[model samples]
Target: MASPLEEKTVARLVAAATAAPSMHNAQPWRFRFLTGERVVLLHADLERAMPRSDPDNRALHIGCGAALFNLRVASVHAGLAPRTRLVPEPEDPLLLAAVHLAGPAERAPDPDLARLYPAIRQRHTSRHPFADKDVPEDVRATLREAAAREGAELLFPGPWHADTVLELVRDAESRDVMDPAANEDLVRWTRLGPEADTAVDGVPEYAFGPRKRDGKAPVRDFTGRRPVADRGSTSFERTAHLALLSTPGDGPADWLRAGQALERVLLEATLADLATSLTSHALEDRDLRLLARDPGSGTGQVQMVLRLGYGPRGPATPRRPVADVLDVV
Candidate 1:
């Protein structure tokens, strides 16, 4: 039997978990609280998997990891410390974790982390052009520390490295434009028009930033096929800030850690009044992945590339209702 306080704590954790961002806002995760054992189990909802974009379920696992991190933070706020086990069982693929709770007195909540909780709901991927002002070096270092605390590495590209990444993104954009299969996959999730039904989760029309007529650094134009009218445009910074999130091993556990780190960095940036976006274009290709990896650095593997700067707030993407995701067992 569980105490009323325990039940209340679990409910609050679930609410916070749902606040995590997901690819295309799929929210592909499910949670169950086991009262007798005082544990919360996170499971990847395979039905919600993005097969085309995430063929191997890596992105799905990443999204679940983000949710798991949120659960931990929420647990802290609710006077508990969360102990997690990633993919606790090999036989049960859907069984992602069993979180054991430690009493609040056992640990003190991190002050910086507590500050970021408010920004969790406010962080949105800003796709529009960033202001010409550069991100301070110290702030970038702080963001790196946030990711490192979550078991990942954040790589800030130098001028040459940034150019390499930009070129890779351009290559990916060109390939995606020519590949019928890739185009179809993007088309499936991209909603057209402002009045389009918001039930399905994906990149909404309004969220797609205006296309660059002069063809500068490649931005994933979600509205490539479906043209929109009167879209506003702004001048993007010439020197873009790019960071790579990497882990040691390329497995389920590593993928989860990378996801958590990714969100932590994003939330930290949000609290600092900075805008961020992620582009996995180069990471999606094997050759480009090799180029992105630094042999000297012991970082596990690059999971995602993030762009950080000061820019307009991106339009909020839609999310599935709590009732649609939560199941009381």
Candidate 2:
């Protein structure tokens, strides 16, 4: 039987995991705490999957990765050492991970990770423009290291590459906007005003930054089809610091690893007081995805496109309650 303290620790971890960001805040994960075995099982909630945007389950894996990171941090805070086995059961496809809790390890918590735990609740994806200030080279290095520690590569593309990627994003935006089915699917998940209160999933109107009336580089317009009145306009950064997250392989396991690394990098950036947003537009297109890979290196597969800089924080998106996501049995 698990001790009372152990049970409490598991509960706390669930709370932390729920705070993780999801694509459109879908929160598409469920947890089962096995007290007798001192293990926590993470499963994907297929019902919450975004079929239109994440048909291949990339974003879903990314969301789960964010939750997994939270669980790890919660374990640290609760004085437990979490040893995780990713995709422990292939037979059960929904089962993503089995985290076995061991008693506290002697090693101190990772100072960088510990510093980011508080920011987990504070970090928001900023769509508004970043100031003209360039992100220092040292900060970029730190962020790169953060991603590396989690089995992902963070590459800052040169201006020419960035421009190429930007054009691809514009293509994606144009396609998504013109396709009625795609727009409809996005509209279904978006919530506004009173609808926001009832929505357990989807992006809230407040979280959608203002619509650009003029020509601005494409940011995923969550509000493209359904306009949100009173959305304020702001000048976007002319020069954005863009980084790509990549993995050595492209499989379910690789995706899970990349997802974990993505959150680690994001949290680290958050702790550094940087605002971040992600675009997988280019990666979503097969030709563009192939182009993203460095032909000579032959090792990395692009997992995400991240934009990082200093900017005003966006509003906090909603999450389902801890009780809703965690099962005591």
Candidate 3:
């Protein structure tokens, strides 16, 4: 077999990697390619970290982990076996992962990874209200499997559990309102008016969807007492379809795994024609996070709360240029 990786192939992989979601669209990741070794390195861009909101840098690591997952998928799609190592260097905390591009005698993509290639670009976070409808059990099973592949659990909470989780989100929202440090992060990461039109990062005004006029979805109100012209109000779904992504341990490694699982489940949901939005707000706090977990099972740390249904898929947000995030050697 010939060389499995070239500059162009690596560039394509990096593009897909850059598309992964970050907390508040911070997009905190950097990539380096060692052509001699055919290894791609993932690093955390500390400059993009939300110091106030993500004090522990858990969200930052999750974002980088998501990017690493995309690289794996993209590599497979390009007929190369991707061998990934998370936190390969304990001495270098910023180095999140290293992926080797292997050229085997038979060069072919993993069927499952290749299957998700199309959904990578199709999946977007939909902040708008979803139509009140039930997601089929088969689809739920697919999502669960996706999470399982990345060593995480996807749980569709019961009605009582969902209510409790929503309450925790509300409590979190109140905390944000009261905490100036929290507001600082939102204000830093949200773009309004003309700023949203040209910004390369941060949540744009158009992507925020309509202000919640009614209903209880754990969607964060990014505006947060700020005013935006033409931002109208709309009623969200009454019974929001909520799924929690969790891992047995809560640490940098687990956060990375959670992020990979998150993107996998998201791609699966998109393929199932389900619109999705994420809520890490509730799980930001330690006490609130515990309250958000499964009362019955009482295991694992909830990484993200995803609300999925049929709705308008969110508009594509901007990302830093490929050259900005990648360095090829």
Output the number of the lDDT-best candidate. 3
Off by over 4 Å in 1: 5-9, 105-112, 194-197, 214-218, 232-234, 295-299
How close to the true structure is residue 176 of candidate 1, measured as C-alpha lDDT?
Answer: 78
**Alpha carbon deviation, residue 92, candidate 1 (Å):** 1.2
| Per-residue lDDT over 1-329 for candidate 3, one digit per residue giving the tens place of the 0 to 100 score | 45636787888999998888899999999999998888999999999998777889988988888888888888888778888898899999999899988865545557799889898898888889999999999999999999999999999999999999998888888887787777898899999999999999999999988999999876888898889889899999999899999999999999999999999999889889999999888877777888888999999999899999999989998888888988999
- Tens digit of lDDT per residue, candidate 1, span 45-136? 98877666677778778888988888887777666767788888989999887787666565555555566677767888778887667789
Give one digit per residue, the lDDT tens place, for model 2 in 255-328. 88888888888888888899888877667666667676644464588888888878887877777877888887
Off by over 4 Å in 3: 1-4, 106-108
| Full ranking by TM-score | 3, 2, 1
Question: Which residue pairs of candidate 3 clash?
Answer: none
TM-score of each: 0.90, 0.93, 0.97
In candidate 3, position 307 carries an lDDT of: 96
Report every candidate's CA lDDT: 0.76, 0.78, 0.89
Residue clash pairs of candidate 2: 129-236
